[model samples]
Target: MLSRRLALAVATGAVAALALGTAAQAAPARHGGHGATLRTLAERPDLLIGTAVDASALAADAPYRAGVSSEFSSVTAENAMKWEVVEPARGSYDWSQADRLVEFAHRHHQEVRGHTLVWHNQLPAWLTSGVADGSIDAAGLRAVLRKHITDEVRHFKGEIYQWDVVNEVFDEDGTYRDSLWLRELGPSYISDAFRWAHEADPKAKLFLNDYNVEGVNAKSTAYYELAKKLRAQGVPVQGLGIQGHLDIQYGFPGDVGDNLARFDALGMQTAFTEIDVRMTLPADEAKLARQAQDYRRLLDACVAVRGCTSFTVWGFSDKYSWVPDTFSGQGAANITDENFVRKPAYTALADGLRAAARRAGRH
Candidate 1:
């Protein structure tokens, strides 16, 4: 089972080492001038500024650990908490990588964001195969899912502050995603997920996280409707997580503030869950400068909104960015370069928070 686990992880990540040269282990631990970290610059103490952590990087890479501990107030297990990594086999679950991330966060006084409980991607081969081949029936699959949520949540009950319970469950057209869960259990699976997660850890704030819903689009509107319906039915849904994966080429999502406000009006908490403004490859200073402005705009919107809580970057450094591997010729998606040097975008983010602090009568 562990062999199966190792094989799956290797299959997905074998290209990272080649794509990204040797680790930035030599990068100095300290960042920014005068020790004005994001944690300290954040005038709103409740606002958590964070980045996702790759477990292998966190383990073998010193600079990586330094970046996470020195900068962020929160950390999300990038892939460690996903089903494939945690439960590689049906009955075999490995919490070592995820547990290390949690323990590391604890030692550094950082809260953890439990990445996902329900997602179509990164599912165990066994689970997916069983479902595809009819070995796992609807009722049986539901029970299996319940066990996962219950065991995983209970395992890390007090450690995690927010759980991206159901991720990317909606399509871009405001329709339910054609996921394994949707295929088996239908749309009710969404609410069922929230209920099961709540039953496991009553205190952990639950969020429905998705990308392409950063603005008031059809996708986001669909989420708003679903959240409203779930609330009406007394489901314990607490947050709407907008994954702000922006591309500088597309300009900024100007309506982000209004979208957050609508969810806020629903007595729901909203977060810019994953904020990264990427650009086309061979990035010039001009493109980087535009990236800075785009980053500032998103942060400013969150700082202005009452219900906007955590602002998390997908990853903090270009060296470990997932952009290039996933998107051809798009790599500069983080606040820092390969050497861990802070970029213009990094300055813009800090300045945005400071600007928010200076603004009077923010209601």
Candidate 2:
């Protein structure tokens, strides 16, 4: 059986499959464009087209590296920057993999998004065990948390453009998820995490990121209230990251524009952080077409909102997606297929960006 963490990692894939099946339909053609790279199309509007990348893939996968460099203007380390990989042992740290990714992004002139200073999943065993064993007290945990955030942020202070200070802190129903942080450090941990990250690197934009909050729903409402409260208290919270992990079956987020607008109204920048539209196995033309439509809708939502500056796919190609393993019988959730072939969704993204560019009078 898959561990709950792995299951949650791909939970969005399952959610996509369930939510979109009945709504899957042919998407109408809105625009036509050819051979436009995401970077070029986004340049005119000052929008950043980015992707989450596995660090090993950056060094080992030639074609994947080329694809990323040629297309995206920003990159986020999918797992390398997470707590498990960065600080597996108490008071010990490793920066090899994360450093490699930051170096690669700088070499390619791509900005970096530091993923997650605080998350419940993917935590180092020692930290969780300490909590579980009662060896680490609440005050000790708070000190440890501060050390982790400060050290990580300080190490990459100028290199990373943004930091996801807190990730997936809320449950789907708008309540705080019962994580170790909340249990030990309480609700103040969230605000403390953001403040610590900011103090470490005052220039890096700090954000709270979550999935299933892309539309104007209960989950998003939670974020809106939190953003408003954080700002009122003068927390260094700057942005909201909506991980747009779409599945063809769930249909597109209809109220995405309104949801983004609400966040923007609170003086916060918003971003489509991790986007991918997946479908069940044995993908057909209609499924692919619907995926294309979903992709377009997400990009359109970001473009329609001011201060919605960045749009990043979870990963660019289906070859390395975490979907299939996490969601049985479901795969191909990315814009490109396994062989680096441009799928319909790829063209749809280009078309959307091109249209946005033209509308902004960049063409």
Candidate 3:
């Protein structure tokens, strides 16, 4: 059976808490262009708003798509580094999709974040069942895993500003997930992944990404201990990726500001990564209002925490979200409906940002 940590990782690939900023300023709306959100938001140095772009978005010749996403300064691809895309046939490699995404970032003059170098979900069938059947022992798994991380990082060196070196390795029970990494090489595989990534590209900031860490729980507690220990061991881990895939059914964090501050106090940067608050099937006004409030609370926490750097929604619009179909009875997560109109959550986030700016000025 898979460990709780591994189960959660498969369930939610998630969090980063970083409030990197210079000064607060209102972002100017773009009239028209073809670029990701960060390309537009990079206009002002104070705020960092971002979103994950699908490969299809880049393919489509949408009108002024850049305008809708202009208030962001950083870009993270949703699935560019998954195992299937990076190592489709175990040894054979394909860099076409990732290469195009990087080129798009360069063309628009935006900083790119490598979604991940290590994950359990998107691994190739060879490794998944191979490890299951004992065809690949611990030593064999370690060799393959390390090589994959090192090569991916080296290939995208200098282009990606930050790399999610080790992603979704913890379970909600605060234990290391029982993944191929755990089953084969044991828990040390995670530290090795981070170390290898650092060796591949020292300039790239390494992050441990996971979901459901927004509030204090067994999972986040384990992350806190891991991060603290890694820092003590002089590991290259730099940031935490908080996959904020919230649900209105469950109450939002009551002390979000304090949670962020606690992480910031630990000397780690925080980022609102993969943020999307969902509602039960057949969304209603009450749920939408709750979702808006949840979004506001998250943004307010980011603004209040000095070290919070980036805030990225999983996707810009609900039309492209992976949630509705992935999770039955769960819909209405993105800032826009399927039709592309701004939802209450979007307005609430912008409003919270403005409030944060005003409060920052007062300070």
Candidate 4:
């Protein structure tokens, strides 16, 4: 069997090259007189550019669908793969929306990254209630969690490339979040989740994904220690996903490359799983330009890391972004405008990808 790193590299190069080549061929009809298409800029063999997409948008919005299909080599479901959507009730599962997104990805010749398997948020009432009341004890909750991970992983065994097995489990101060899982199942919940997910689908890369861990700080240090400990204990954790949700207000993370390098040294692949550089309302030329710079820097950081195989935007277009809804006065986080027109940030990303491809070519 090929080593994990070799297997990942080969898969990434083959998929990205094929996707870029196909997209480049279709650029004229799709993008018309637009400068360089995202695919054209991402004609690199070793890296995959991706975006999260809503299932409804994929089905109903032609422009959204076309932009996603042509610009990205990988697709992540924004909400379909969440626990609430997958298992809304105890033992009752729904796969319709998730399956739609997966099928859409397959049709576009793009790999699918499962958004998440275990998270503190987006939990169904049934599961949370079981945890709240005495209905589901510690052991019962553990069993339910295992089943959820196993069933979900098994269902999408060969379809998904990676899964955020345990998401945002740590707090900002380097401590475990007092989530339902932590409260009931204890800290071993994270390791158990990874193991269960691996048992269900040994081939899929299991990742610990989180926000605010893009830079070397307390939270990321927590991840570094936990990842080291897990690997030392022979856990199946294979990747670290830094959710690069940047805001112009807070400025960009300065040590993103170093942060990725530290995780890469732990024998784990790193990915910018959910990237979006948002700005305050009423975007101006200067703000857009700064966003472009931020986007470029982020791509630069990812490409500079050998183990960073994927860079995924949270969503491709501002029309479907979660920024405005989640954070008041913060919007326009995507590379595309509401009309599916490429923004300056999009150009910066394309240019960064092209430069990274050239750098990779030299090596």
Candidate 5:
């Protein structure tokens, strides 16, 4: 749960009031700057750059062009594929919007990275309310979960390149978050989710995604243990997604490359997923500069790791970011301002990628 202070900020829309810039200043509604689609971004020899987008923001006739384009080869849905949006009710499914999003990506020649199949947040009211009775029989819960995973993965099939099979399973404290899955399926629910996803879409890569795992710490250690155990059992887990939701004021973890290497040694691909460096509101030159460097560090970490596959920002523009709403005093987590103007961090990221490419070629 978000802290009470942050929740209040989200509720009052004060965060939204602090818009990045007027839409009039934004660049013409078009695809990404690098003239690349999500798939192309992923194919880059360097780090894959990407951002999340809402389906309603782009035009249906040419959604790919008018939307925030990235050199990123892979695109992830912000929330469209989550349980709440996909299967809002028990047994009943609503794949209409999500299918359209995936179809749009295919039409535009992009690879869709399924945001998540299982998560503790944004659950449907029915599921949460049903579990409230505390009498959720194991068999019933398992059947429901299995069916949800089976149908969704089967539905997407070849459209999705990767699936975040289990998301935010661990809390900042390194223990499994108190979630329904833990309550019903024990800790093994995670492996089950991954196994089910693979069975449903054998070709799709499976990733374990979470925030606060960018460095060696209690949370990362927990992930390391889980990854090690899963790999030893040949659990078919394909990758690890380090969510880079950073804060410039709070010094970043210096051993990011080391941590990522540890995961790579486990034989799983690594990705910087949901990246955005937030700072206290009222951006200053120093804060912006630090934010740029923060981005460089994250990109550098990805470049340093051989198996790191992609790097994705949670959102491309401050105008569309979920940060301000999700966390108090975080109005500038995006690389672009409200008007779609590139921020200094954008340049820093491009520079980092170019440097990494040059370094890779030297070898």
Candidate 6:
């Protein structure tokens, strides 16, 4: 949501437990050589490999649709389920486009991770304006927010595997981001949001998602402390989402494994939720090679952590990447080019998954 992430723009587009043989048995990649699809390699490690999907592109582009359907076993709606798209007019809700996505997931035999139930960005105008003008008093704001979470969660209750109950709530400095909810409701908003979401879908794992928390730094420490507090209060806060939006220019976040280890110690689900490594300007073989290592590094961290159950790329192709638009002079963040060709980073992920499968097999 911040500079570290303009996470999922539009365009683009795991696991199991079983024998290594079982992974080998899963479908081979359409274009991948001797190696099976990333989804297949994930089976033995019992991890979910996924991507943020652009619903419009899925509907109109055949190659994009095929790529999503075959390459990943889980899907998150890039913007389909966001507040502005689903509840554009406050009380008026439209689930047409979002429902199509859920259906597509079902048809592809993919699990769905709800993009978010609470976020400061992409909010509908009516809600923000109401809050701005004091038309939505604190109590009224609370009620409205509760209703939004309840309705959305209840509608897709049993189908969704997880819900990003609160997203990008904290800034890089470890302070709660100033927003309508924070200003009116104070810090209690995070716990309240989780409670409301849990009440609506008890089966779904509720997660606190944010960027820049890929390591055990200030931002991640804030999440760790808050998650510990929430769970102690019986808040049903069940997961931590690390948005792995890395940049090759900054080098990889070396402590990602250590960060995920701490969360694993918390005994809650953790995931590399939205990962994409970007470089500055034109891509060279060296930059691309380093990008591959970055992708491999993040995926390796997740595979090594017991509680980390999923790894997802923000989007799969550069054709529809949000990077160029959001960050000037930085592009080539995805694993594929515009024509759906795989890159070194794509192979790196496949290799990581295979290694995980081998490890799982050894055990």
Candidate number that wins on lDDT, 1 or 5: 1
- Global lDDT scores for all candidate models: 0.84, 0.83, 0.71, 0.84, 0.74, 0.82
Clashes of each: 0, 5, 30, 0, 8, 4
TM-score of 1: 0.90
lDDT for predicted candidate 2 compared with the true structure: 0.83
Reference-based TM-score, model 5? 0.85
Q: Candidate 2: where are CA atoms >4 Å away?
A: 1-35
lDDT (10s digit) by residue, model 3, range 1-363: 122332342244221101111111112232122222232322224345777878776567352144233445557888877777878888999988888877765544346778887787788898888888989888888888888888888888888766777888988798788776776677887788889999998887778889988877778778878888988898877888788999888877666676677778889887788899888878888888999898888877777776777787888677788987889989889877775566788778766765565665732
In candidate 4, position 320 carries an lDDT of 89
Per residue, candidate 6 scores C-alpha lDDT tens digits across 108-171 of 6577889899899999999998988989899999999999999999988877887899999888
Ranking by TM-score: 4, 6, 1, 2, 5, 3
> Which residue pairs come into collision in candidate 2?
19-249, 19-250, 20-249, 20-250, 21-249
Angstrom error of the Cα, residue 265, model 3: value is: 1.8
Candidate 2 per-residue lDDT, tens place, 1-363, comes to: 122322342345455233222122111111234434677567543467899998878788777877777677788999999999988888789999999888776555567888989999999999889889999999999999999999999999888777899999898899999999888888999999999999999888899999998898888899899989988999999999999887877857768899999888887889889998889989999999999999898899899988797899999988899999999999999988887777899898898987887898878
Error of 5 at 173 (Å): 2.7
- RMSDs, each prediction? 8.8, 10.5, 9.2, 3.5, 10.0, 6.8
Which residue pairs collide, candidate 6?
13-316, 14-48, 14-49, 16-46
Candidate 1 residue lDDT tens string, 1-363: 012222333354444223222222234534555556675567454688899998889998788777787677789998999999999988898999999998887655567889999999999999999988999999999999999999999999877888999999889999999988998999888899999999999988999999988789999999999999999999999999988899988857759889999999999988888888888989899999999998888898888888888999999999899999999989899999987888999999888876777784332
lDDT of 1 at 209: 95
C-alpha-based local distance difference test score of model 6: 0.82
Model 5 lDDT per residue over 1-363, tens place: 122332343355433223211221233433234542222223353344566757666543232334443234446788889999988878788987788777655543345778888889888888878778755578778878888888999998877766888999888888889888898789888888888889998888899999888989999889889989997887888888888989987888868999999988988888888999998899888888899899889888887888887788887778777888878877788876776566788778767766665776742
Candidate 4 lDDT over residue span 1-363, tens digit each: 223333463467667457545655543324432445564466654567889988888888766777787787778989998989999878899999999888777666667888899999998899888778889899998998899999999999888788889999999999999998888878999999999999998988899999999899999999999999999999999999988999888868868889999988888899899999999999999999999998889888988888887899999899889899999998999888887767889878877876776776842
